[model samples]
Target: MRRRLAALLCCLLCLTGCATLAPPYETPAPASSSHWPAGAAYPTLADNAGPLAMHLPLGQVFPDQRLQQLLSLAIANNRDLRQAVIAIEQSRAQFQIEGAALLPQVDAEAQGYRERRPADLSGTGQSRITSEYRAGLGVSAYELDLFGRIRSLRDQALQTYLATEEARRAVHIGLVAEVASAWLTLAADQEHLRLARETLTSQEASYRLIQSRYDAGISSALDLHQAQTSVDNARIDIARYSRLVAQDQNALTLLVGSAIPANLLPEGLQDIRIAISEPAIGLPSQVLLQRPDILQAEHQLRAAYANIGAARAAFFPSIHLLGSFGSASAELTDLFQAGSLAWSFTPQISVPIFDAQRNRLRLRVAETERDLLLARYDKAIQTAFREVADALAAFGTLDTQLQAQRSLVDATANSYNLSQARYQQGIDSYLNVLDSQRALYRAQQELISTELGRQLNRTSLYRALGGGWYTSEPS
Candidate 1:
């Protein structure tokens, strides 16, 4: 009997290794074109021409030592990113819990019990007391996965965990890009403030000269008023830029999650040049697959597929084993004696016959979820393609815009100087001088703004190409 029982257990173990019912997984092709848009602006290289573009480390991406230091602090202390890391850990634990269910769970237990029986029920004239002691190692309701249900559930959990990991990577990339942009913005605002202050000083000097000429009866009241107006405008700009600089600092502080060091903060655009080299953009098909968000979406789709497998398996019979090997006796001291040795094996089989169509509904739900994830996966790819295209378009043109803006600044400066000289010699009206001054001021401001935009475009392109995270150092 013992040998037969052992053989039966072995057979059951062999039978428990069932084939998965999950549909074969195939990555759906994106509906968009295989290559990036073609144009002189949209450059492409042969797929095998060289290695795909590599992501630059944060240190290399932000060559400014101060920006690099701030990025490090943000990555370590940012609350949102810290929470994302914790979420990954939680998902990993949950996956392990689900995976453990695929195998038997053995537990050691000890117990003591006492019971009393009424005389009438005992068939004796008096009440009777009974005492029992038990100690054992047991398997309680361990499901033998003959239909792959447990296996499928485990796979689903694993994929979900992997998706969460990808999400964390996405967060890391976003944080790095945001910090770089914020630092650059603060620097630009500081430069704007400095320019306003200098312009105000120059305007005040001109106002003083025109006021003296008016007092000497050599200049009209209109000349004095116009010069004063220029001074006033410059003063107003000073105040506005001061406020903006403060606000930019506050924004950077918030992103860093702590007070930034004064030395680490940007003083001007020139001081914090975003001089990172542009990364090579590879073929769209090759690059899009590596985007963290797209990978996360694909993992979710795989998880949904696994859920469908589990649902399909639910339609078949399930077998569970509940058994215990132990000793039981009225006296605790004799619990392990020869006669006290005892064992029990209970195998339960459950066949689905009628459950109000619950199994069918579950299968339908899984299928619907899979379809939803499939749509989301495709959307992720499409969105990435659009972002890359837009960034590339901006990058191809911003340098030209910057170049034109610098020329405009130079031309306006020359016009201002010539107009001032003509006004002093009584060859032109003060209005022309004022007009020239205004034009020069506007052109200078635009040049600063354009320079900042050019730098920011590089950052955006790096992020759009998914080059900021997962390749090296954290930030």
Candidate 2:
């Protein structure tokens, strides 16, 4: 038995021959960028010791617990995230199947059959009945991964699984950002509505005062007409903002996968505040490694690398060990008897002697694909870094712009109030009062929009930095 084993090993070794495979992988370096956008030009906050692009610590960035709960629900119930999870499970199953290729497979087999044969040309006196029965334990086809084909495939599967995991994380981040953005829009719209109502109330009061003066034979008909026009215009905006707020609320509900509880939406815009600590992006390349998209891209590159290794390994021969042990007999009662026992062992080798260069072409194709993935990875990193910087700069500059807009709104409001009083007292013309009210209304609307813009920029920065969504903080 030892000699036979030794001979079988020799035959296996002879069939495999020798082949060289690629070495282990090393993470490629991230590319660098030089210039970034300016916050002064854009509506962004100044760095103020923080970088234009900052990596926020991941531990619970969402300040509000209610919003966090909504995000959690979205992660669990969102349709897109569920699909990504299913994809991960499929990759895991494929990994398991590929992993099993490196090990031998054993199975037990049992069968029984009956057949009748005619006595052709009187070779037998009469028709004969035959019965066959067999039972055995057998080793089925299994590949010996000498050149690491199966191992490479398993590794590829692992990378694919990781990629899917990152995809889910990315989706999670997106959902959180979307929910936050929608909430901000709702808040902004509500604030705009409030401002519109206030403006309308003030205009209505002015219209009544102007009509009283006109009835008292003090003010002109044009003054009452202008006052009525201002009130009507303000009323229109109130309706618009009210509609926008409701639309935004319904959209937020859809994103959250259920009706937004009364407690979920903040009472008013002032009650809803976005807490963003400005981040300083160290270097462009670092941003790529931190961004989930770039990480996913890197994983794809690794999967492609593993595929190339697998294709290269296909150039070599494959070895399989086969074994069978069974008992068989014409009589069913003796099918398992010692005298009916049989056993056989075979080691097979398959080499790609001639296949019209198919294997070589596959290797070539894999190489090209790996190269494509590498380039894509590099480009993705660059893009992520750019986006982070852009978002940071925008948020910083917008902070300053928001301040200016607030000041404008305040100054215009006071000016409008003084003008209305003067015009009622016959100290100024009605046209002057109309102009002031127009300016005040425009400023109020601009302030609301700028505030919303700032909040949106904050959300963009968080998404760009790949912040939040994960349970643990960023390393």
lDDT of 1 at 213: 94
Q: What is the per-residue lDDT of model 2 for residues 40-111, given as tens digits with 9 covering 90 to 100?
A: 554322223233344444334666776677777777777777887898899889889888776678899888
Report every candidate's CA lDDT.
Answer: 0.85, 0.76
Candidate 1 local accuracy as lDDT? 0.85
User: In model 2, where is the ten-residue run with the lowest total lDDT?
Assistant: 43-52
Top of the candidates by TM-score: 1
Query: For candidate 1, which ten residues in a row score worst on lDDT?
Result: 466-475
After superposition on all CA atoms, what RMSD does each candidate show versus the true structure? 2.9, 4.2
What shift in Å separates residue 144 of candidate 2 from its native position after superposition? 2.3
Could you give candidate 1's per-residue lDDT for residues 1-475 as a string of tens digits?
9899989888887776777788889999985678767666653433432444566666766789888889899999998899999999999998999889977999998899998999987778789998999999999999888778888898999999999999998988888888889899888888888999999999999989988999999999999999989999988998999999889889888888998989898787875655554335556776888888988999999999999989999999988999998999998899998999878899999999999999999999999999999999988999999998887777777777889999999999999999999999999999999999999999989988998997888788778777652222211
The residue pairs found clashing in candidate 1 are none
Highest lDDT: give the candidate number.
Answer: 1
TM-score, each model? 0.95, 0.87
lDDT of 1 at 436: 98
